[model samples]
Target: MENSDVVIGVIFLSQTIFGFLGNSFLVYHYLMLYFVGCKLKFTDWILQHLIVANFLTLLCKGIPHTVSAFGLKDFLDDIGCKLIFYLHRIGRGVSISSTCFLSVFQAITISPKSSRWTQLKVKSPSYIASCVYMSWVLSFIVNIAFPMYMTARWYNRNITRLRVFEFCSSVQHDKTSDIVNAVFISIPDVLLVVLMLWSSGYMVCILYRHKQRMKHIHRSNFSFKSSAEFRATKIILLLVSTFVFFYTISCILQINMSLTHNPNSLWVNMASIVAACFPAVSPFLVISRSLCSACAGNRIS
Candidate 1:
């Protein structure tokens, strides 16, 4: 088999394995969340929205491509390609938006009395539903143009040179397409990164303040609350950090791949794998925190 075959094979195996594992666990956890009588609190609602989005991401995009990589029937004809890519892009756009919402929600949840987000903190499940519904609608509206802009094009058999997979490719980026794509992608990415950065920075600042307060109180210079909360915050921080890192890497690789050419390039697929890893790990990390043994113990007591 050629290196292309080998590369695609490994890529398929990894996608299948990760897709199965991630989506299966996400489904299980979602079911458990529903069945365990855990009221769909605001944060829980956010998590559910995220889980649903990630599941869609994996299903609409990951699984079909995985099957195709394994030599499954090319069921995604022109129309199928249009719909699949459109829906997949919508779901992924939602994923990014939902994540931004999560970070903002968390920051608001932890806001001090002086903060302006305090008012939103008083809202309950109803507001949660409204926000989540808005998120879905916003995501859909933002990405609806994807299908409009993308069309299936068969490479002319005569053209000896092309880029990427030619069974379907966007026509050269026009002014309208360039504007739409940039607007859609940039807004969510910018909002998410900004929220993530602000929340993470605020957490560190608050932790610093608390540590100083502890030292002033105990005079011991060692603080248990600071240590413990940092541990919890660190988990969430790590999840966000890893995602940002991998996302940056994937984006850079995509830019490079577009500018350069190598059908045999391993980095291109590696970047896809990296981008896929975030959704794979995000849910379990959320589950790990939400369903902590301490919370379970508190319930028992």
Candidate 2:
């Protein structure tokens, strides 16, 4: 156990514990909202699924990296490696898709009545559950090849062309196969990220126009600052920015890893750490928004 590895393990442990607790709190809060007969919005359903996916992502990726970082050997068998990697990939895909959906939904929700998105804004809520389910199904279908390529790390054999992880090793396919697989795996992610960015831009334009319109009517900066619209916009941008920043870093690392025959363990650990950041941080952001909304509702009532 090198000192650096130990430090990485400690970091992973902390992220896993904090992310689990934060997501668990969110899960409990939503369950209570349902049980208390509170009317949940369509976006609430998407958020519920997103939190679950985040927990899944943290658990599958974090625990293994932590165990491996501490110099644990043979912790996972072949079946375990395949199952964990497959599930982690699915969780990641769902997180990406759900975030895109949420952003697009919100953009539509806030669009002016005469805008082109008005029809979608009216009809979008009803399909939230179906959209979430389809994302899971598509993710599963797309990543089904992962388990076939993954196996437990072989200690005795000297594998020359394998990309070894902490507990698992992926077989390096031939060039044509590798290109095809990469394309299939990355297409959905690329599409989702594009949609998310587009919707985020749309939201920003709407917010800017809204602020300009409000300035003439209110004539008070404090009133605009205190408004729910401003608060919600701020939260959305923060969430989207956090997701994109960490996600982009992880993607770059992943690309670098793919281009190398033997990926560096340090690079792997760094990628995992960045990958876990959004999931770990996002729940606290949502919880803050929830608390704020609750306070505002109380004052209103």
Candidate 3:
């Protein structure tokens, strides 16, 4: 058990290091844009919020756990467990908000003259601040008591073998409290999924409309505006699609574990890794926009 955990720990440790370096470069680059007061023309102020949210997601999930893995220390005392889990939950919530907001922003940006949101489009930036604020507040409200529901247990004392981080036990509270926790957790998940699905469908619709329009127009070449927007849309779609895919699977595994009672160490660890991978991989995937742009137009077809 120790041997297997050690091997996996080493691998995740590497992921932790690489994720940090990449996100660090991204954070620095975006900060330069913010500091220089660069007019973010093609995009809007929301990109700043997205970048910050991604950075937090990566930092919270990747850094401390890496340290814990390398030290071969669970370090999940009561306070420690609560703090780590709470912060990571916040990061996770913020990520969902940022991604959903990105989708809506893109949809608004590309809305046609006949669209209902056209008036909202006129003052898009004005509406964006409020939406992002609401996203944060909504996420915070839903997840505020998450830490209270989780308890840290010494792995050997509670189970056959030790695992990374202290094991977490859940509510022995009243049925009402348990129901509340489940509903609170589930509400955001459902809402985010709906937001992402709607945004994705909306983006696909716009892309198809653009394609149909292109067929009639002079295909002289790609205009930079059209090219940039299309590529950005593709990248955002890919990120959100990946998020939804893995997120759905992880949620299923969690539910399965909940219902079935016995989740082996292997299954438990694998589920943890699967859930963890989405947030870690998301930043790099988003940043890869630059590399793929040269071929994005070709791929878009």
Candidate 2 deviates by what RMSD? 2.9
The local distance difference test score of model 2 is: 0.83
Candidate 2 Cα errors over 4 Å, as ranges = 155-158, 219-226, 291-301
For candidate 3, write residues 1-301 as lDDT tens digits: 3677677667667666666666676667656655655545434355556556655655655555455445544556666666666766776677677777778777887778788988878787667678788877876777778777555565225533322332454435554765677787888768877987997899999999899888888767768877777878888788789888878887888776654444665565556666666666766786777522233223211
Candidate 3 lowest-lDDT run of ten: 292-301
> lDDT for every model?
0.61, 0.83, 0.66
Better of 2 and 3 by lDDT: 2
TM-score of decoy 1: 0.77
Off by more than 4 A, model 1: 71-75, 124-129, 151-163, 175-180, 215-232, 257-268, 287-301
Off by over 4 Å in 3: 35-37, 41-44, 63-73, 154-168, 171-179, 260-262, 291-301
lDDT tens per residue, model 1, 95-176:
7666666666655665667878677777734565676688678767777766654444452232234344423444445457
RMSD per candidate (Å) reads 4.3, 2.9, 5.4
- Candidate ordering by TM-score (highest first): 2, 3, 1
Encode model 2's per-residue lDDT on 1-301: one tens digit a residue: 7999989999999999999988999888877766655666666678888898998899888899999999995798888888999999999999998888888887887788999887887678867657779999998999998888888897325587677876788888788898899998999999999999999999999889887887788465556334665566567777888899999999999989888887788888998999898899889988878732332232211
Task: Compare the candidates by TM-score and give the number of the best one.
Answer: 2
Clashing pairs in 2: none
Candidate 2, after superposition: displacement of residue 94 in Å?
0.3
- Name the candidate, 1 or 2, with the larger TM-score value: 2
